[model samples]
Target: MYSKKVVIRYTATNVDQPIICQLVKKHDLDFNILKAQILPRREGVIVVELSGSKENFDKGIRFLKEKGLTVEPVSKNVSQNNDKCVHCGACTAFCPTDALYLERQSMKVLFDAEKCNGCELCVLACPPRAMEVNIF
Candidate 1:
């Protein structure tokens, strides 16, 4: 099966739609939602790993775009600049994978690259802009 991690951005009007559900029912795809934040009348974002035949995967992505959703490959890399990090732990709360965590005794934040799914939430939550997403 073909599989890839992707990020989907939803506009206010499309935030409530069951678009991902249709990917499974209509396109015969399997998906694992890594992270999501959906709210009524507000923009939404979801990070998911979709699996299916190559043709079906292409079709599913096309379907998303047609529905006015923006779909892009999840960043290939997420990194933290230790020099810039104050270790405030803001990113730990938003990280779905626990890739960012605090060393309680030292109160220092640490990152485990292997645990990261590249959801980009940490990048958004980091107060010092220490978290960085690298598409390349």
Candidate 2:
């Protein structure tokens, strides 16, 4: 079996809740929240990582776009600046995929794109807008 991974990002305002829920239900797709920083601020980005059959993946993308979600291909390049970071853990805490982590000794933030769902929660939480999503 072959599978493809797609990431979707969107603000709370753009989200179509019912459509998202319905797609999840109908496709039996695995949805993982990569970030949720915008929840508290009433505006945030959601990153969902979906892996399934190619056909289902395509359908899922269409469904998300129709629902008003910004869907895009995940990119490896991430805009992160550790110098400006304060190690507040906001990004780590908000990461739904456990992709961001803090080193035990240095307390530095790290990112794993493979595990990232491309949700922009970290982007929304960063005070300096350090985290950037590269949609291809």
Candidate 3:
């Protein structure tokens, strides 16, 4: 199974959220609303985390696009070589979802992409620049 994080930007008064939510729920997918900010211009930006099978993920993205909602993909940076990681806790500390953690014995940091909120805090906090976020 695969998961995806989606960021949605739209007007606050838009009633289309329920439609999107219904479609996602129909697929038995799980989602979280991370950030919601009402801008001075009366628009809003809503960040959401979605987890499910690849089929559901693709369907959800397509559904949002068909509804004319702006959708962006967000996830942890895994492109960096693991050997380059210093196992520093800086990135873990900034993870909004506690997705990064170090093993008590090996001291090796593990990343849980499913738990990640795709906030990009870990990427910015990494001193080694190991964490990467691909926004689409």
Candidate 4:
């Protein structure tokens, strides 16, 4: 199966729509919602991992764009800047996938890029701004 992680932005007009459901039902796609913060009549965002046939995946993404939603890949890479990281463990607290964690013995922070879902929570929580997202 083809799979990719994506970030979808919703404006107030489409915030209440069952867009993800449509992706599944109409485009034969499967998705895992990694993170979401949506409210009625307001801008919202969702990070999701979608999997399906390549053609179906393309159709599903096109459908989202047709609905006036902004869709983009989560990131090409998510990395930690060791030069800037203090290893305070702040980013670890916000990492739902355990991609960032504290190494108790060394008192250092470690990042595992494979486990990250690209939700961007670590980027927001890191006080030192060590966690970085490279979209390209």
Q: lDDT at 88 for candidate 3? A: 81
In candidate 4 the C-alpha lDDT for residue 37 amounts to 84
Give the alpha carbon lDDT tens digit for every residue of 4-30 in model 3.
666776664553356557767777678
Q: Candidate 1: what lDDT? A: 0.87
Q: lDDT of candidate 2 vs native?
A: 0.66
Clashing pairs in 3: 77-132
lDDT of 3 at 105: 98
Question: TM-score: which candidate is best?
Answer: 4
Worst 10 residues of 1 by lDDT: 71-80
Query: How many pairs of residues collide in model 4?
Result: 0
lDDT of 2 by residue, 1-136 (tens): 3343445555666543555678878776767655443454244455556666767777878887877776655545455676676767789889888888988988778877778755567889888767886543
Q: At residue 104, give the lDDT of candidate 3.
A: 88
- Clashing residue pairs in candidate 4 are none
lDDT of 1 by residue, 1-136 (tens): 8988988989999998998998789899999987787878899888889999999999999999999999987754578898999998899899988989998998899998878876788888988899997542
Separately for all candidates shown, the number of backbone clashes (residues 3 or more apart, or on different chains) is 0, 3, 1, 0
Ranking by TM-score: 4, 1, 3, 2
Model 1 clash pairs are: none
**TM-score per model over all chains:** 0.60, 0.47, 0.52, 0.63
